[model samples]
Target: MAEVDVGKPLPAITSEAKPFWEAAAQNKLVMQRCRDCQAYVWTPRPACYECGSERLEWQELSGKGQVYSFTVIRQVVGRAASMAFEKEIPYVIAWIDLDEGPRMISNVVGCPVEDVKLGMTVSVVFEQQSPEVWLPKFKPLVS
Candidate 1:
């Protein structure tokens, strides 16, 4: 199944990825945690990214992290080019190292693109791109 149109291509819902997307639709950030190694699995693989264990369970995240890396998207290309995104030029895309040890590739919103920096503290904000998809974004965590 597919989510509502967010003016961009939605992710293809696979059997393995269904749980992750389902939690997002409910405005929650979740990842697969390996039961054997106790490691969080990203990318929704069938096995743990750490110990290659198949015993995995869905776990919610605290939504706190630091900007491990970032880039200012001055332009969009390929499937990313859309009218909705055109108005969001010069956005900040970043790799956020979550407090739970997973790094998420997401956009840094609610701040100027130029203000985004490496090591910046951030917290999650769910953007409901469509009714069935709440895209996880981050913003600078205010002290």
Candidate 2:
């Protein structure tokens, strides 16, 4: 039921979060939408943020978004990130505002941090961390 870092002390997977992780394994992004207010929400709860209604369901998104904000990690500073962290140290991590109206934290890969900017168009790509798990990553949308 766990993906990424099977035996390691990290990559802890939980029951409440299993579905989201499972869906991501299929290269899909899932976010709960409030059935009452039709508002997109994150953290996967059974209620609406706008109307406080308990009617919610998970929906798949296009996985396209704009970078709201980001940081270029120039150093690993720890070993838990990855064994190749040194090589991939300088990476961009960002909060992306999905077209569905929810913002989620994720990493922006396949590009240099210097080129990353706020409001940059991006689309999703999946990296298989395990046979049953794929992490959703993003790349700049080329015009």
Query: How does each model score on TM-score?
Result: 0.89, 0.81
How far is 21's C-alpha from truth in model 2 (Å)?
1.9
Q: Which ten residues in a row have the lowest lDDT in candidate 1?
A: 1-10
Per-residue alpha-carbon lDDT of candidate 1 for residues 18-112, written as tens digits (9 for 90 to 100): 88888987778899999999999888989997888899999999889999999898988875675667778989889999999999899999999
Candidate 2: lDDT over CA atoms?
Answer: 0.80
Candidate number of the best lDDT:
1
| Cα-based lDDT at residue 100, candidate 2 | 79
The parts of candidate 2 lying over 4 Å away from their true place are: 1-11, 78-84
The TM-score between candidate 2 and the true structure equals 0.81
Pairs that collide in candidate 1 are none
lDDT, residue 98, candidate 2: 87
Q: Which segments of model 1 are wrong by more than 4 Å? A: 1-4
lDDT of each: 0.88, 0.80
- C-alpha root-mean-square deviation, each candidate: 2.6, 3.3
